[model samples]
Target: MIILGLIAGALTTGCWLPQLFKSWRTRSTKDFSWLYLAVFGTGILLWMIYGAIKGDLAITVTNSLTLTLTLAVVGLKFWLDVLKPRVRARAEPPAGGPSQRSVLPVDARAVADGTGDPARAEM
Candidate 1:
């Protein structure tokens, strides 16, 4: 039964990955409901507290890990969609620069691989 419970926990918790990845790739969270994550994560945190009080290892571990992963997604959503834009706005001006037209912003791999052209890389 513990094995089954752990498996279920892992399956459900793992669901966050694809959504997080989608948000990361798109650099947008317009489709994701922030309020839902906040509420649901609060419930998960409460469960972790309950598990601790009951000395239930399975519940505590599962909910603790889930809460961490959920918070990571929320942080990424804020960073990629919200803070990144403000930083980008500062980097570019009305006249524009060469960095503006040739490519979108990119990760270090693109620069390290000597393929600074993100559009050509199809990332």
Candidate 2:
């Protein structure tokens, strides 16, 4: 029974390491879902609290470790989604401006037919 408990703890702990490492190294969680991670972290925290209340060592240890891992992933996702993108967007110039290259000629037929806005017609 003790050996089984140890094995289960080790396995559960091992499963979270990969996600922790990936989030740590990349520092980017674009592909990760913040909503899912948030919900998952909340669930893990609840599990930890329940395990503690029940006085189950195995449940407590596993849930504690899982909560830590889930928090790391969730925090990274929040940073990437809320903070990093805003910083990047602020750094970039506004759109709808002139480019460095020469402008292409507009089609007269399209302009004559008024398919597009007349303001877009070439002089």
Candidate 3:
């Protein structure tokens, strides 16, 4: 049972790295939803609390690690999307307006248009 528990924890926690790396490489959070992160982080906190009450080592350990990673992602999102822009603007309000974001979001409409589907056809 302990081995099974460890495997379960490993699978869940292991998935966090790729996500973290992707975000780090991109350096933009335009594709991530603030609301989703908030709700997910809150759920992880609740899971930790529940694990403590139940004396479940697996839950406690897994959620503790997950919470740490989750919070890091949230913090990164806040730093990149909110705080950094304001600091940049104040520090060097460009002669023109603020420069464009480092990354532009993928537009669904453009993808659909390219697909040549009748639904995407212009009226």
Candidate 4:
């Protein structure tokens, strides 16, 4: 029974390792949903609290570890999703001429009249 509990705890905790590793390596959470992770982390915390209240060591340990892992991933996701973009947007551009892709002001009147320069009209 003790061995089984240990194995179960290990397996449950191990489930989060791949996600943590992926998030760490990519350092981008564009594909991850913040709300989903937030909900999952909350659920794990609740489970941990319930396990503690029930006095089940395996449950407590597994849920506690899972909660911690979830929190770590969620925290990273939040930073990558919310903070990194803002930081990157504010970062200084390299010492070169502005890229051709830079935004150009459009002539709304020309667009409305449908007789803007051929290049600008296409855009």
Candidate 5:
């Protein structure tokens, strides 16, 4: 039973590697919705808690490791999809320099609409 649990835990916990690698390589998570990551992470966390309460070593260890892996992807998504863009948007343009393209997609749109300062919208 212990061996079986270990084998099963290893397989299940390792299954997230491909997706995590792809996300890290691409530095993009546009295909993933914020809702999906949140809900799935929440479920994994609950499973970890359940395993802890049940005193199941394999379950607890596997879910804890899986949660860590899941959070890496979540952090990448948050950083690349959310925080980085906001930071870029807030960035000021170079002084006395030609206007450059906006790095943030939203700011680029604002530029198209002529609502944002072209200089500040610079990448």
Candidate 6:
């Protein structure tokens, strides 16, 4: 029973690794909604607490580790998606600043047509 519990716990907890790795590698968590992270993280915390109360080693350990991984992903999302953009915006001059130049050609049809799709524009 103990061995089975260990294996199950490991499999469930290890599932978080790939997503964590991708978020770190991309430095973007744009796909993760703020609401989902909040609710999911809260549920994990609740499960960990329930496991502790029941004196279940497998549940407690697995949830504790999973919570740590979830927090890391959430931290990356907040830093990369939320904080970094704000910092970059503050660092950059406002649009139409003297140093700013349009990347599109002056005769770009997308600009004239108001399509707003840079890819559709003729360079």
lDDT of 3 by residue, 32-80 (tens): 7989888988998999899889988888899899999988888889999
Residues 1-123 of candidate 6: C-alpha lDDT, one tens digit per residue: 767876888898899999999988988788999899899989989989998999888888888998999899999998998899999999998777745466446556566688666655556
> What are the root-mean-square deviations of the candidates from the true structure over C-alphas?
12.5, 9.1, 15.3, 9.8, 11.2, 9.4
Q: After superposition, how far is residue 77 of candidate 4 from its true place, in Å?
A: 0.8
What's the TM-score of each model vs. the native?
0.69, 0.65, 0.72, 0.68, 0.71, 0.75
Best by TM-score: 6
Better of 2 and 4 by TM-score: 4
lDDT of 2: 0.77
Candidate 2 residue spans exceeding 4 A from truth: 96-123
Clashes of each: 0, 0, 0, 0, 0, 0
Please give, for residues 1-123, the per-residue lDDT of candidate 2 as tens digits: 656866787798789888778877988777777677778778878877887898878878888888877787777777777988999988766687654433566666887787866567665
The window of 10 residues in a row where model 1 has the poorest summed lDDT is: 96-105
Candidate 6: residue 35 Cα off by (Å): 1.8
Candidate 2: pairs in clash: none
lDDT of each: 0.81, 0.77, 0.81, 0.80, 0.85, 0.85
List the lowest-lDDT window of 10 residues for candidate 5.
Answer: 97-106
- Sort every candidate by TM-score, greatest first: 6, 3, 5, 1, 4, 2
Q: What is the lDDT of residue 90 in candidate 3?
A: 84
Q: Is candidate 1 or candidate 3 better by TM-score?
A: 3
User: Which residue pairs does candidate 5 place in steric collision?
Assistant: none
Model 6: residues with Cα > 4 Å off, grouped in runs: 100-123
TM-score comparison, 2 vs 5, better candidate: 5
